[model samples]
Target: MLSFNTTIRKIHLWLGLTCGLIASFSGLTGSLYVWQPEITAALNPELLKVENVENIKEVTILKSVVSLIETHKDSLNKIFLPYREQQTIAIQFKNGKTNYYHPVTSEFLGEKSASISFFENLLNLHRTLGIPQIGKYIIGTSAIIFFIILITSGVYIWWKAYANNLKKGFKVKWKAKKKKFNFDLHKALGIYFFIPLIIIAFTGSYFTYNAVYKSALKVFDNPNTHLINQQKNKNFSTLNETLLNSNEKYALRAIYFPKDKSGMYRIRYIKDRFIKAGYRKTKEVEINEKGDITTLSDFRFDSNSNRIVAQFYPIHIGEIAGICGRILVFISGMVPLVLLITGFRIYRLKKNKGLKKK
Candidate 1:
């Protein structure tokens, strides 16, 4: 019978071979997603940034934006008003085309291609490879197995090395010969980053299999929650305008207009300033056309479980600490790819040596 350590090594080897391709693809895409906010801002500044916040127009411009929607006529869906001074007005069409305009001038900046937006496409690729439902399950199952491999393999390697010698386990010999160097990279770097790698795997899993995450939330007794208003929809757009004008603390990110007469409009926003709270400290308001505010939800006021669930996005993308956090996440995203390469090298070298000896 195989020894316990030998069996673990075989499992680790096979698991890496089976899942390494998907993991590498995920890491590469996730690295790009880590800089999503900055990329969008940099690529489309005219639509994403304002030159003069001081000369900003009044709420009447919303009416003007609404008028522009008439150009789309029957095809027009709804206009999105961003609270940030730099953000341009977004006009979405029922046909799925999106156009950007200057919030102040209403100048038609450009239209988003139906093919896909850069970050949005990248996000879909990372999450579901642009194939929902089935793709999500595939990625989620792979992520769970990846998580297990990380734990079992990482602990086994660390324990084996320490059993051999303390320094050998903890230190990588920079000046070592090529094979030794590769071996150290696989083991030492893996040990150093084990915890963070586990976190990345878990958060990726949570995003891919949200039902599993929701089920976990039940342990905290935080049931799924949403706002429900008894009143009917009446002039919901005007009500949203009123709310936007009244609030200055939160910056409106997006607005989902009521679909039918009975539907409620959902407005989502982020706190204006903070290192950790920009994404985590979000608020939403659901209002009907009747000008009745039905539901108001804020992360700050959420339960511990709800709040924990809310942090998943920020944590996954390293948005928790702003720029510095993104850098950490970017580097971590590269780790899985690195491990795949180095681990394969070690396996091949050992295999060849054993074959030659035979």
Candidate 2:
């Protein structure tokens, strides 16, 4: 039988030696990402309008804010109406640069960005270094390598502890010598985070490698059936046309509109077909005042594996988890940093001890 970590060990060693810091940095930054709202709130409490406005319409508020912003708008092109869990009708827009405004009262909230964006920058650096094309590949490859290291180290550490039949594997032995202590932390925490870490790695790798998606089509014996497939309708239809034209088979839960050309208004819904085929979507449709869809000739949603793959990253990242899921992932992400610091400290102490004896 092949040894559990025979190959895993080599992979783990190389990744840890080469990219451990990057992995830890990525984890730390990722952990912070889930808490963005908290950071945003803390950074600028004024951004959140606490007044309860019952008569407020999301679109109305968005328009009010858009008009105010447009008065100063330069390169201020498209604006994404903010949709978060809490009360936020701020429309994110750009004007030679980027800014946001309150939809209510058409109040100019002034140009502001979250100090917490630093965390995003850190994460980008950890993930892609804020560059595209070349940067994307760099981060993608590193993420793949990082996944291997996480899996192998986790399995090896778990094995080393379990084979010894040690009852204290999960708990810290604070009184133990340094190296043993770090090993304990690393092993115990690795076991704790194995599943989540694995998920993050897998989802991350999925984003990095396009080949995996191609192979998926062949493996699943279906092309794009699992993905939420939406095609563009060359008919040049408007959003109103789509809304008036098609009768949807399912009740849409949410809708997203693309701000510019080539972008589509994607409506997301769960129908009976979704469970078997994953989620379905309307083809990239046009957008209008009522958020109407494009002409019936506009592309329709295809129940394909490709659409299913689209959901994986969001789901794994806890975006699909709703607020509670994000909290759990946030906690898990932070745990890795503790594990890294404590593990390294323990390792160093042990090394010094061995050197003294030598």
Candidate 3:
């Protein structure tokens, strides 16, 4: 059998050629995604209008908001409660989504989703390539190809450099020729970035195929991080009323009432956000079938888990990295494209020289 090195190189070279454009496009979009907050702020500041709310308990406010939504006859798909320190509570329904009164009282601070307020098409382009089902496959394949290309180039370059006593690796003569310069930059940058690119590739792959990571995390029996459907309680009205009675300090991220006696009412809280930031807090509050708040015993902020599970996707996509982290991703993402360009120039020069000799 041919060695693993030979096989992977072939895969990398062919895949790189086939998918380089897709990879470049995906990377470009990804680079933009990291700066979405800044872009949104610049483009539509009014959408993320600022305001203050003083005298509202999270639970009662949440119930009243839900009731309001019900009166509007909106089909509830998801409910988001408000947390302390954040300005707005959100309720997402299937038919026509609605935003409750912003904590901004006394001033008619209006609300909007895709237009004046809370939506951007650019974001959809970043994640889904602005293409949808077809785009996902393209991006997913690009991610895998990116890794394959890196490894192939890395192995060939490293092996070639070290094979000749490792002494020839450092001296790319500047008195130099264009070929020498091109090859040197290609090799130099590749070495500097092999690790970061690999991390990006693997993490990205997690989104394309989640089963692998899910299984890996399962080895330690720690897969219980996600929540399942809740049991329904007989007294939905009473439970809802009781929860409204409790005091909550954080913005809600998720909310669901169970279907049966053994079920629990689950609510998630996150710091006010339409923008990603460094110092953020998240937690979940659980009101059990017995009207017991099992999360942190008293305040919901102290609840151990995120009211919802934000798995590997965001971190993989570099969204978790606030701002500076995104800039790093932008730099690293552009490297492969640079390599592609320089590598071709060198390859063309070498090919012409070989013909001249013949």
Candidate 4:
């Protein structure tokens, strides 16, 4: 019978091999996705950005939306306001068509389907492996298993090295034999990148298992009071006035127009001027046809649970720590691939020794 320590070691080895490829793929894709915004801007310069635009007037944005409304009518689902001076306004239709217009001149730049974008497909693969119905569940399960492997491997590493030499566990033996060097490299990389790997896996899982997250929020007394108004669509003549009034108080980011008659107009923005527009800093509000604005959700005034939930995205994507955080996350995403290679080398070394003994 195998000893308990040996059993755990075997478990760790097997688990890592089982899902190592998937984890590595996820890491590589996630690393590329870290720079997606910049890459996308570079790829679609003319469609996403404009020239000779100094400042965008509020009335220009209003007229642009009204024009789009007149053209698309009730088919319009959402309008993404330009976040920067040169960026164009983006509108999404209910049929999944997205179009961009100049924020200053309201000139039609281009349109594309989300289904065809390379980055969109990359995101889909990261989340669901490009599989349709059950892809998310598969990815979610792999994340759970990957998380377990981290814990188990961490414990095994500590168990083996703590009593002997904790310092040696963290350092790779460059002067040692190939096998010893591979083993040390694996251990060191795993230890150094463990926290980031754990964070990425946990947050990725959080998105997939959102139902459980919502349930946990309920336990933490999150009110979740942002229900749809369910009223019929009224004249949108007051929309421009409502937007202008809100813009005076908040830095508007995006506006999600009502889907149908029952849907309310949802506005996402940041209240503090000093705070950069990010998932953590953003707040939301809903506007009824009567033009009454209601606070949807603000993490600052929300329950601790809600605040924690708000941090997940930024933390996962490394936006919370800014550029430095992004760099760290990008490197962390590559660590899994390194670990897999070193781990396989170590396994092969051990297997050959066992065969020789037999």
Candidate 5:
């Protein structure tokens, strides 16, 4: 019978082979997604940027929303407030299309372009392998395997090195043969980049198993926290008034106009710092046409689990630390592919040597 260490090595090798393709795909696409915001801005500068930003003032939120409704004849699903003067407000419609308007001029630029469509497809492919519900579970399961391999193999590598010579664990034998070099590169890179790689795997798993994360949050957050208010009236003008009367400055992120008599206007916004800073703080206000604040959710006062859940996406994509964080995540995504190649080669060489000895 194989020893415990031998069994774990087999498990790690097989797991890596099984999930290698999908995991590599996720890493490659995730690297691209890290710069999605920048790519979007570059692809559609006319829609995303503006000139004379200094001279431009904030447009009336209610007026712009009303104009969108009158022109499109579609219920306003949400309004994305620009984080910067050069950025444009995105008015999302019930039809699942978003129209970009100059925040200063309120000039209609255009709908989402092919580039945005391509990016969306890329995201879906990354998350679901271009497959829907079933693919998500597969990815989630693979993520768990990744975490297990990281823990088991990582400890084993260091422990075995320590048993041989304590210093061997830290030093790469550059003058060694091809196989030794490969082994050193794999072990060294794994140790050096372990933290970020583990983070990416854990968070990416959360995205794949979001239902599990949501259920876990129920233990901390009030069960009724997500339930929508039933008292909806079409008096959004009053809702707008209440927002205007508030002393605090807020940049709108999204506004959900009531769909029926029972639907409430759910407004999500941010205050303090640009939205590009991952909007570390956010406030969600749900109110009826009567202008009564029916429900208020603020990240500042949220429970610990709630806060973690809210920050999960930003943390996963490295938006929390801005450009530097994104670059780290992008590089981390590529490490697994390197490990897979080196690891498989090592396994093949070991298997051939064992056969020769037999």
Candidate 6:
């Protein structure tokens, strides 16, 4: 019978082989996704950018939205507020089309289909492997296995191998024989990048198994009932009131128009310091036609569970620490591919040696 350490090694090896490709695909796609916003803007400059005009008043934005609603009517879905003067206001329609308008003039510049965009496809593949319902579960399960089983077992195998010679675990023996070099590369990279890999995997799993995380966190027992308010009203003018009434300290991020008579207007806000990479730090509010504003969710004032939940997106993509963090996350995504290659090489070499001995 194999010893406990040996059994763990076997488990780690097989699990790595089984889920290695999935993890690699996810990592590569995730790295690309880290720059999706920038890349999308670069690729569609005419649609994304506009003239850098002076102070765009709330009345101007309201007029633009009202004009858009008059033409588009009930098809309008959500309106994304421009982050800067040069950025165009994006209005997404129920028909899956996103039309960009001049922030100051409300002139239609261009439009794109959500289903056909390159990044949209890439995001779909990353999240669900381009498969529908079951794909997310598969990716989520793989992430869980990667996070829990493979990482822990791999660490144990490494510790068991290098407990006596700890220094060897940190460095790759580049001048050594092919098999030894491969082993060292695999072990060193795994040990060095394991923390990031674990974070990425955990966050990915958190998205897929959100209920599980929330349940584990004990946040579901008493949910925030005040997050959304449903009523029978559709007044486009309320958007202007929402804009005017909004806190001037917080920069408006986006405004989600109600879909039906029962829906309420939702507004998103971000602090000035976090304007660049503030995915998790945003504050959301919902307003009815009566101008009764309800605080939906704010990261700064959220419960511990809610705050942790909000941090998952930024942490997963490395937006938590801004550009430097994103760079680290991008590199971490690529490490899995390298580890997979070296691990396969080592496995093949060992198998070949065993065959020769036989």
TM-score of each: 0.83, 0.68, 0.66, 0.84, 0.83, 0.86
Better of 1 and 3 by TM-score: 1
Predicted candidate 5 versus true structure: per-residue lDDT over 94-162, tens digit per residue: 878888986655688999889878888989988888876798878777777777675457667567766
CA-RMSD of model 6: 3.9
Using TM-score as the measure, which candidate wins?
Answer: 6
Best by lDDT: 6
Candidate-wise lDDT, in order: 0.70, 0.56, 0.56, 0.74, 0.72, 0.77
Relative to the true structure, candidate 2 reaches a TM of 0.68
Count steric clashes of candidate 6.
Answer: 0
Q: Model 2 over residues 45-149: C-alpha lDDT tens digits?
A: 566544554456444543454465447443434443433322443433433344555656666565556463576576676567678777767667766766666
Ranking by TM-score: 6, 4, 1, 5, 2, 3
Query: Best to worst by lDDT, what's the order?
Result: 6, 4, 5, 1, 3, 2
Clashes of each: 7, 18, 14, 0, 0, 0
Over all chains combined, what TM-score does candidate 1 have?
A: 0.83
Q: Would you list the clashing residue pairs of candidate 5?
A: none
For residues 131-154, what per-residue lDDT tens digits would candidate 4 score against the true structure? 898988888878878887655565
Off by over 4 Å in 1: 53-86, 113-116, 221-249, 273-279
For residue 67, give model 6's deviation from the true position in Å.
4.1
**CA error at residue 160 for candidate 4, angstroms:** 2.2
Better of 1 and 2 by lDDT: 1
